[model samples]
Target: MENIWEVSPLHRQVKSEGEMTDLYKIEIRDLARAFCGALFLALPLHYTMEMWARARAIPSFMLVVILVAAYLLNVGYCYYSNFKGRPARQVPWLDALESLGVGIVASTITLLLIDQVNAHMSFDVIMSCIALESVPTSFGASLAKSQLSAGNKEDDLTDGWATDKKKILACLLGGLMFAFNVGATAEPIVIATSINYGQLIGIVVFSLLVSYLMVFMTAFEKEKEDEGAVMGPQWAETLICYSVSLLASAALLFMFGYLTPTTPHNLAIPWVVVLGYATTLGGSAGRLII
Candidate 1:
């Protein structure tokens, strides 16, 4: 009767009443940590390799239109899904792995696949940032869900529908993170192309991650999960996250392009220094400041 997508009853007992207030706080805290790790790893470890993905252009005009509709629709859907009293499930895998996969895919799409749309950005980098950002977010949100429960197994089956109002809101937030990121990243790429044909297969993967997060968060807790609405992390943590990203961007400038095959004059040079210095200012740094 148990499924991989459903969190076991044991895991639900992991948190106590005092934790309810921390649901949101935990989510924001983890988010900052994950992004920071990504920046530190991505900045210096693989910029040139990311740049090498020239996959070619394709028809994407229609696709662009669809994505725009989806972005708006999904944001609304996030709100709708929760209030509707839809079914919920649990899933395996820590939130970090989810985040890492997203970061890699976004990097790939931005560095290589976007060219498929005639070199136009079907989305803005912000969108990809959204997609990657949402991965672990679902897991973070779920902590709240799992910690708070409706009380007793006897009524959980039918009455659970009542929780939809709040659950749906959380779903919308998670979905918005994915849809916005996908559209935003693809927007710039799609604009360059006349048509918005299917994006590289990655969008599906991203969607799956988002969907998983919603159910995973819903079922992961045991004690009548509702903790996120209670507590929130300090803004200071958000600042640290942005700061780490800035440092990562600088590191990225130096580590990448050292081995590119471009011609001698065409090879990257002092541009690295300028980029190293410039990227830090507005890059992840801004995320922290805000």
Candidate 2:
């Protein structure tokens, strides 16, 4: 479907004098939604101590990697999920790029207002922080369609593969939300636990098993008890969903400063696996809503 945020030629033809003003109004509304969505997700990370330290500590090359990854994810989401039913030509790549830009701008403005940036910091440091923080904010910005739209039409819904894809996206969002909530406060807990390899392995096994049961066995609604049966083969469905949750867990941990590039692989692996347990549960719960 053509982006609702975009003004079509038909809109421009409706009395020339007011056309520009109408278009401007639409653009303003889109920008406002984008900014609001970005802020909603970025604020927690903005205040995070680990995020601040990572911003200053991560190498320039890694900063570029994060920026590129964020951009690509935003673009893919825009194309496959956000603009799914729109005419391909109308869903311009520019919109995806622009959404990322909006996220970066919003993050920068927010950080500045919060006094996270000051003359004491070098220009590189400020940019690095803004860029690092923008990744999650950009993901939120790309979700503006679902995030901001309260009255989305029934026609926007999908079927078959698209439907499955939407579920996956929902899982990612749910996992991110759950992880962020705990991640903000869980660093101390993670440090205190510091489990051994055996315990870490147990956490990983428990996470997968619980996630599978949560999605398949727990009856959130009696009518939907068999919903998991329709997703695919039981094993494949569980594996795919669990993988998405694990990836989200790791990313959020890194983003929140629970995991860092400097940390040894052994330590980071266990932390991520342990946290993945919570995230997988959150992801399964997310699927239920969809």
Q: Rate residue 172 of model 1 by lDDT.
A: 32
My TM-score estimates for the predictions, one after another, are: 0.23, 0.73
Instruction: List where candidate 2 sits over 4 angstroms from the true fold.
Output: 1-21, 79-92, 151-193, 196-202, 217-231, 247-266, 285-290
Backbone collisions counted per model:
51, 2
What's model 2's lDDT at 270?
69
For lDDT, the strongest prediction is: 2
Error of 2 at 183 (Å): 6.2
Tell me the lDDT of candidate 1: 0.31
Q: How much is the lDDT of residue 165 in candidate 1?
A: 38
Give the whole-model CA lDDT for all candidates, comma-separated: 0.31, 0.67
